[model samples]
Target: MSLISILTPEIKKAVTLLFDANIDTIEFQATRREFEGDITMVVFPLLKVIKGNPVELGNKIGTYLVENVTEVQAYNVVSGFLNIVISADYYLDFFNDVKADKQFGMVEPNPDDKAVMVEYSSPNTNKPLHLGHVRNNLLGYSVAEIIKASGKKVYKTQIINDRGIHICKSMLAWQKFGNGETPESAGLKGDKIVGNYYVKFDQAYKGEISELIATGLSEDDAKKQAPLILEAQQMLLDWEAGKPEVISLWKTMNQWVYDGFATTYENMGVDFDSYYYESNTYLLGKEVVQMGLEKGIFEKDPDGSVWIDLTEDGLDRKIVLRSDGTAVYMTQDIGTAIQRVKDFPDVGGMVYTVGNEQDYHFKVLFLILKKLGFDWSTNLFHLSYGMVDLPSGKMKSREGTVVDADDLMNEMMQTAQTISEDLGKLDGYSEDEKTTLYRTIGLGALKYYILKVDPKKRILFNPEESVDFAGNTGPFIQYTYARIQSIIRKADFDFASKTFSAGEITLHEKEKELIKVLALYPEVIQNAAVNHSPALIANYTYDLVKEYNSFYQTVPILGSDDENAKMFRVQLSKKVGETIASAFKLLGISVPNRM
Candidate 1:
């Protein structure tokens, strides 16, 4: 049992026995650094039921606890806080319980528990992914892993925007400018090649608009009359009509983008259980809108469009379908959501990993689902995150100012290489090993830097700052893990085969502190799961590493005066490394065995 579990009821019993007063709850926190206790119980909350001086009240409860519950070794009354020092046996017993258990801090999923579908990295097929997509993919993948760790069956999914004017812009531009250039011919990734055409289309459209404006046409009229845009729109219409040439072109280009996306996802270590394409699902929600209209959940505009009036719900009326009865993005999203539930019958909830700009959109969508009377609508969540900006400012995909995901990853690796070499640590590594380590450290640095902060806050990422070997970064935690691994390697004894008991060996304060931090791993995972924040896992691992480092510096592992103490400390270091690896696994980061 945890310290909290063992002590809560005991404290309640102590209060009743001593003060003849009943208490409903007990609040326990970690003892402050200046205090000489393991766990502190605030006496202020108990004061409501027992009328007395807090120090005296704490002393009475403390005295009762030490005499009765054996785990309470000692206590100190500091104003309202009753800091209780738990017995060394308690920490040792806890450590022994977990020492041999490899998967100590993770929960086993109940077979009867409902599954959760996490939707993320739903990139449009028109362009290659950018820095914003990097954050989305990392967050989504980490959250899925964390949810899985929290004992829920998780399915990772994405909705690809395959059919739209945006997609056709690339296609039309490719046909107009290319001399039958393929991705192979262009010597580029398919998405990168296609993305070039997308930018080309924009530049050409702007040039046409400028010419039209020079002819005395208003800016809006020039934009509407641009020949390039007109052709792209026509291509979209042709695609919708299932014209052979346009449909064939659309399929070809979309396949290129998918191939490119697969490579990127593989490199970035994100995966999807299923994919939903807009071409197939665009018309899905039209029927749902009709169903909503018949059920009075939605209203029809005079132009034969579908809308849900959410003004009474504190949102404006949003269109579901166009006047011509074509499905809008909202309509497609509705159908996509319902389709997921049908696809995964066991799913009881869904998390949409989208940007904060669409916060209102999800609110309105969830409300509409609830109004449409889906039982699982209440379980829906929007894991909305803010944008990632560079020091240079915002990124625009069409303008080509955006930081490409693949390029940024390479840059991160290069940065890792530069910093690692400057540190002069790779003494005997092979070329392949050095290269692999650089990529691992680079990616780890990138992921940990972004994930260490709250998801709702925008990040101004600095590659140099993130790759540092010290402080609250990925390399820091990873280096600590590596250090533990080195200790385990040098121990010369079979530490894994032996288990240490809580004998007459005296406990070091550093050892107790390290175990205490280790004990919080499971609680941290649960908290991260509840809040849908990988930041918790990232930071919790940092704290664990910090504590372990303090223990390392202050105490001896292999050279301890006592043989059993030395072996136990070595085992403790091994377990700490395992826990760090487990936590980093939840954040989709890899730890190096050497630094």
Candidate 2:
């Protein structure tokens, strides 16, 4: 059992000691920064049917909690709240227990007969991934890992946004302006090549629209009068017809983009069991529309466009199929889910790691799935995260300032390499080890930066606020791990000979706090999994590492004369490093032993 579960019985006894079994419900939460202990209770919330003032009630509860609880060192009555402090002895025992159990605080999954599908990093072929996509990818990857660690059978998948008029625009620009160029021929990344064409389409169309407006055309008239969109639409129609030349071109270009994406995904250290492409599923969307229409879940307008009426659910009706029988974005998602269920009938859940802007879209999608009698539809999750913005403003492609994922990764790795060299931490490492260390440090920095914030909160990307090597960043935690490894190497101590100490050592304040935090790692993962937030785990690791560092600074460990103290610190540091590394792994980051 996890530490939290083990403590529950003790907490219950404390509560039962103070009040009549029926008077108050014991509500204990792992405390927050504003609170005083590992567990805190607010008596004011319970005193609704009682007679005493909050502080008096708190004192009575506090007194009962301390006297009745074996693990509790003391309890304080602050205003209406009872803050229960765990004994240093008890806290140290808890930490030592955590350190001894070598699973690094991971618990076995509970019995649940449901499979989960987590979809993430659905990048469009028209452009490369950017900082926004990085946030989505990291959050999605972490959430899936956490859920899987919780004992759920998770199916990790990706849906490539490969088809649409947007893609057509790129193809059209490449066809009209270029004389048949390929990534190899141009010496450019495939995604960048495709993106350049997309940008060209916008620029060319903009110039045309502006000149038309100057020639007395209204704004709407200018856009409508322009033939670029229509040409793009025609390309889409041709694509749908399986035109040999257009199909070949699309396949070739998309393959390059796919290859480029695979490289990025590899560096990010996230993998999916399967992939679904829009080109393959757009037709599936059309079939779903027909099924919905036959079942009266949707209707066709005079123009023969199919739409679902969402008014009953307080949402606007959405068009599923156009008059020309083309599928919209939502239609394709519906098809993808249906195909996925058929492919894996045992799969009981699906998660869409999408931005919050499409909140309404997923809400409608889930509701529609339920209305269609898919019971597992209730298990569908939209892991909606907020957008990533630059400090200056929203990322604009027109300004040519969109941060390319590949370029950013290279820069981070190079920066990490330079930092490692300057720190003189790589003196004894081989060239290959140095390279691997750089990858670990670079990727760790990227992951930490992305996962440090709540997924639902907007983040401002700042190059100036890069991940610090000495502060609450990935490198900082990595350095701690490296230090522990260095010390372990020097000591040449066999881990197999380690023994548990009887009773608790009189630990310093930092040691007690660090132990308590370390003991809570399993619960931290469980909570992060349930809440779909990696930031919580990230923050917890940071706090634990910070405390460990403080302890290391205050106490000597390697050659200390006190055998018990030395062994205690060594064992504690090893476990802390292990736990921190495990946490980083959940976020798709790595820690290097050398640097």
Candidate 3:
């Protein structure tokens, strides 16, 4: 059991016995720095059941905890807070027990527990993934790992938007402008090769629209009447009708995009257990619409369109099926979601990692599902996140200004190389090792900077700022981890298997603080899983690294004259590095054994 678990009930018992009051929940927080304790109990909440002076109340409980709990060595009362100083022996015992644990603070999922499905990187095949998709993929992958660590089975998945008018636009451009150029002939990634055509289509579309407007047409009419766009629209219709030539072309182009996306996902270190293509699931929710109509969950308009009225539920009306009997995006989504449940019967919930622009859409979709009577709908969550902006501004794919995922990753590696060379940390390393370390540090900086912030808040990503080896950045923590590794390497003794017996030696203040921070790992992981936030895990890791650094600077490890103290500190350093690696793994980041 954890220290918090063992103390919660005891603290409650102390409160009950001393104040003669019943409390349902115990409020405990880390002791403030200015306070002389390791954990604190808030006395303000107890006033409702036991009215008394706040400071006096704190003193009474503080006295009770020291007398009754074996771990509690001392206590202090400040204002309405009772700070309890736990014995150093307790921390040493806890650390000793966990030092050799390879899977420390992580739990295994029980077979009986319902599995969770996380959906991310729902990219349209029209263009290669951009900066926004990086954040989405990283967030999804990390959250899935965290959920698994918290003792629930998790499945990672994505939906490919392979069929739409947008896709036809790219196809039309490639056909009209190209002399049948292929990704192989062009020596480009299939997605990037196809993505160039997407941009070409937009440029041609704008030129055609401008020409039509010059000939006395309104901008909206010009856009609608443009020959290229009309052809693309016809192509969508033909593709839906399964025209032989169009279907063949569609398959070829989508294959190129798929091959291209596979490379990107591999490089980004994200994966999916299953996938849903819009082409396969586009017609799915039509039958569901009929079910909704029969159950009165949806109403048929005079034009035969199906819609769910949610105005009374504080949302606007939303259409499920059009009057022409064609399914909308929402219909396809409904069908896709249902299909997933059928595919993975154990899945009890889903997390959709979508941008904040779709906030209203998901709200409507979740509500519609509840109205349609799906039991799993209750567990649905929309992990809405804000846009990732650059220092310059927002990105536009059609304008060819969006940051390509592959190119951005390469740029990060280059930047890392430059910075590392300047820092002169790669002495005596071979070229290949240097390359690997550069990519590791670069990607680490990128992932950590993005994941450390709250998902709902917009981020202004600066690669240079992120890679700096100080001030809560990824490379900063990575450097600290590497420093610990260097210390472990210098120690000739076996620190891995040999640690001091618990309570055998006295503890320094910094050592106690480090242990306290280490003890919070399991709780941090649990909280990160429950709230679906990688930011929690990211910041917790930063805090742990900071505490370890403080201990490293103030305390002597191998230089200690006392052999017991030297061995114990080296063992402590190894544990810190292990914990760092563990936390970084959950974020899809790797820590180098050497800098």
Candidate 4:
């Protein structure tokens, strides 16, 4: 049981016995560095019910705890705080209990609990995955893992935007550009080649717009009359009509993009349990719109566009379908959400991992779902995150200035290799081993750097800083894990097989601090899951590593003369290593045994 769980009821009882007051809640925080206590309780809240001086009240509660609770060694009243020093035996007992359990912080999912489906990396098929997609994937994937660790069954999913005018543009560009070139023929990943055509489409479409503008057309009219765009629009119509040639080309190009996306997903260390395609789902909400119209949830204009007015709910009217009987993005999203719950009947909630630019969109979507009477609407969460900017500037996909995901990952690996070589820590490693370690350190740095920040805050990512071996960087935590592994390897005795008695050796201050932090892992995981944030887990792991490093430097493990003390320290070190690995796993980062 956690310290809070143990002390809450006891503290309530103390309040009742001493002041005849019944309190329902207790607020506890970590003891300040100068305070001689493990946990500090706020005595001011008790003032609301019991009228007395705060310090005197704190002393009374402290005396009660000391007399009734064996774990309470001593207490000091500082202002309105009751700082209680717990016995060394409590921490030692905690360490001993959890030392042998490898999966100490992870909880098993309850079979009766509802599952969650997380959607992320929902990239359009017209372009390859980019740096923005990287953030979405990492956040979504890490959130899913954290939720799973907190004991919920999670399904990772994405919606591929495969059918649209944008997709038609890429197809038309590919068709217009000379000798038919396939991914194999172009010697490029399928997505890369398709992305090149997307750029090409933009180039030709711009030239046509310029010509039209020179003929005295307004810019907007020029853009609309651009021959390339007109052709792309016709191509989209052909695709929708199932024209044999257009359908074949669409299938072929989409397959190429899919194959390319698979490779990138594998390299980037993200996966999905299921995928929804826009082509298959775009027409799904039309019947629902008709049903909404009949039920008066949605209103139709004279032009026949379907919409839901949410002005009274503090949002504007949202269009679900166009006057041309075509579904809007909102319609598709609505349909996709319902389809997922139908596909996975156990899914009671969903998390949409999209950029913050669509924050209002999700608000409208959720409200619409709720108004449409779906019971699961309340569980829908928008994991809206801020944009990631480079030191250079923001990226533009149409102009082809966006950082590609594959290229960024490769650059990270190269940066890791360069930094590791300069550090001179791989003297005895083989070539293949060095390569793998570089990738591990590189990807670890990238993921940790991004995941360490709160999702709502914009990131100014600097790759060089992320790979550093000091500070709160990934390599710093990873190096600590590796150091612990080295110590475990050097220990001559089997610490795992040993157990310590209650009074075998008194705990060091650093040892107690380490155990306290270790005890917080489960709570941290649950908190991270509840908030839908990976920054919590990332920072908590860093804290644990920092505490372990402090303990390592101040205390001797293998070098200790006392057998029991040395065994206990080594076992503690091993558990710390296991926890670092476990926590890193949730963040989709790999901790190397050596770095």
Candidate 5:
């Protein structure tokens, strides 16, 4: 039922006919915009082969396609471009096919296949989820769903960065200043509990460093002075040794962070199949390093550090193990990958949905994995999205400018509520109903904002500019869905029970365009899945809704007394509502029945 399978065959036939007619060197393409054409064949390349004027050649090809192609009702030639429009009857037939088949846009799976593992949102436990993590979660979830829709088995995982010097800082401060305070007692988020300590540590350490410098210690010496590092370092030692008190504190604090994160994930509508903790996996890196040394894949530096050579690959060499026998970040990733593969033996690919800042890191990891004789290492994919920047440049955590995930969601919801009230859309909504609508509108806005653009593109996040409710935004699409819902409710159309005349749809131009878009849902999912870009689905959904809205604005359905007119328009709206729901599902955005 995928549109591409049907249209690709049509494209190949058209290509064959063009070649047979002595037209050479032309490329056939399908476009979603500019023309109501299913396919656009750029014939400028064939102008030289035909030895004729470009426009005339285009006209010739257009005539030939319309005359010879049964799917094409007409073809328009503009500036050497031939736009072959499919028959309106064909679109109506496509709509009927989609309405009849539950798996209208989804393709049949290949009998044989490979598995894909996606790792995303590996947040540190010291802080609550933030906007950057939100982007990561949405991209990861969307990619997972899209891949599944494309008939691939996908494993979704996350590696919690639960152990490090940063964690020690939080532990140290909490031990010194927290005085038995707990999230339950303070009513603060688990991450916030740890994060308070992190901030306190910074404030205290900065002053302590300044005092040391005032006592004439050099900046470097004061910063890394023995006593200062001892407090933080002791926390790590306590954690490693599983000191009863430290272990109890760590367990309590980490559980709270996990609980808070679960709430955020629930709000965002994202889930993971497996969760990996660095507290456990950090030690795993050593085993991989030992194995690498045994296999002669890595050599020790003069300082007793294990290093991997990367100069030949046009990158600097990287450390795998430090002189003191401690594993580095890259080493932990290796162990994690190995563990994951063992967990899912048939996994053929590993997709790391981290930011672009780690592009070089993944490249080195993939190369090292390949050198270590892992064939599937070649399938390593880094879904590196760009950093979210503000009008004031990149967001920095140290400067307290990073947007917390919970706060951002609250602000978006509040904004959605204000807009809803201003528009008079939910005037009589009950408090509970209003709450539900707010969640839908707020989440839809947040998701659409993050996903409407290409992931790898650096997007400017302006509070005033980012969350537009009108053009190309989530609310617009949701509004279109709501309008369709209203239409269905008002008309009380029982499309599920009633049958319409197969070809009697008096399709309007806009209705035909909407149907064509609705027919592309499965194809869009497949493309987005392959590219690992949720933005594609987001954009497609927005476009679909926009067209549906245009059609709705132009055509009246329920009021029409004519059976064919009313039924056809109702059917079109039904298909649109169905298609939009599917697109929203792919983006991890939910549309309430009312909103």
Candidate 6:
């Protein structure tokens, strides 16, 4: 049980006995640094039910805890704060019990509980995955893992936007650009080749608009009348109508993009449990719209368009079906959500990991589902996050100015290599080992740099700063893990086989502090899962590393002459390393044994 769980009822008993009153809850905080205690209880809140000075109440509770609680070694009151020092045995016992469990912080999913589905990286096939997609994938993947670690069954999914006018533009551009070129012939990944055509389509369409404008046509007229754009629009109609030739080309091109995406996902260390396609799901919500209309959840205009008026709920009217009887994006999303629950019957909740630009769209989507009388809609969450910008500024995919995900991964690896060589820490390593280490450090820097920030905040990512060996960077933490590994290697004795009695050794102040931080891992994982924030786990690992390093510098481990103390310190260091590895695994980042 947690210290809070164990102390709460006892403290309540003390309050009832001393003041003849009852209290429902206890307020606890980390003991202040200047205070000589491990945990603190705020005595001020008890004033609501009892009449007494805060300090006097605190002293009475402190005396009670010291007399009645075995874990309470001593206590002091600083104004309204009752700081309690826990026994050294409590810290030692906790370390010994959890030291050997590889999955110490993670909980196994209970079969009886409902599962959660997380959607992320729902990229359009018209372009390659870029920096924005990078953030989306990392956030979604990490959140899914964290939820699973918190004991829920999690499913990771993404809906590939394979059909749209934007896709038709790329197809038309490829068809018109002369002799047909395949991915093999173009010496490019399928997605990159397809993305090139997307950019080409935009360039050609712009050139046509400029020419028409020069001939005195209005810019808006030129844009609508651009021959290339007109052809692309017709192509979308043809694809929708199931023209054999258009369908064949669409299948071929989308397959290429899928093949390229598979490679990118593998390199990025993210995966999906299932996939959805927009082409199959786009027309799904029409029947649902009819059901909503019959149920009075929706209204139809005289023009025969359908909408849901959410003005009372602080939102405007949102169209589900147009006057032309075509479904909007919102309609597709509604159907997709329902379809997923059908696919995974046990799913009780879903988290949509999309950028903040569509915050209002999700609001309407979830509210509409609730109005439609879906029970699971109450569990829906939109994991809305801000955009990631480079120091160079915002990116436009059509203009070919976006930071490509694959290219960025390569740059990170290169950055890692440069920094690793400069640090002169690669002695006795083979070329292949160096390559693997560089990738580990590079990707670690990338994932940690992005995940370390709160999901709702915009990130200005700097590659050079992220790879630094000091400060709160990934390499720094990885280096600390590696340092622990080295200490373990030099121990010469079997630290794992030796067990020290909790009463046999008095813990050092640093050792006690380290154990306190270690005790927080389980709670950290649970909190990260609850808040849907990987930033919690990321920062917690950083803090643990900081605490371990402080303990390392102040205490003797393998160097200590006292064998019992030395063995205990080495065992503590090993546990810290294992915890680091386990935490990084949740973030989809790998750590090296030697760095």
Error of 1 at 495 (Å): 2.3
Q: How far is candidate 4 from the true structure (C-alpha RMSD, Å)?
A: 1.1
Q: Which candidate ranks first by lDDT, i.e. highest?
A: 6
- Candidate 2's C-alpha runs over 4 A off are 1-18, 23-25, 29-38, 48-69, 109-112, 210-219, 225-229, 290-296, 299-303, 323-325, 398-400, 418-432, 494-496, 503-505
Better candidate by lDDT, 1 or 4: 4
Error of 6 at 331 (Å): 0.7
Q: How accurate is candidate 2 locally (lDDT)?
A: 0.80
TM-score of each: 0.97, 0.90, 0.98, 0.98, 0.91, 0.99
* CA-lDDT, candidates in order: 0.92, 0.80, 0.91, 0.93, 0.80, 0.95
What value of lDDT does candidate 3 attain over all alpha carbons? 0.91
Q: Candidate 1 vs candidate 5: which has greater lDDT?
A: 1
TM-score (C-alpha, index-matched) for candidate 1: 0.97
Give one digit per residue, the lDDT tens place, for model 6 in 156-265: 99999999999999999999982699999988999998999999999999999999999999999999999999999999999989999999999999999999999999
Task: For candidate 2, give the lDDT of residue 459.
Answer: 81
Off by over 4 Å in 4: none
Worst 10 residues of 2 by lDDT: 15-24
The alpha-carbon lDDT assigned to residue 64 of candidate 2 equals 66
Error of 5 at 396 (Å): 4.3
Better of 1 and 5 by TM-score: 1
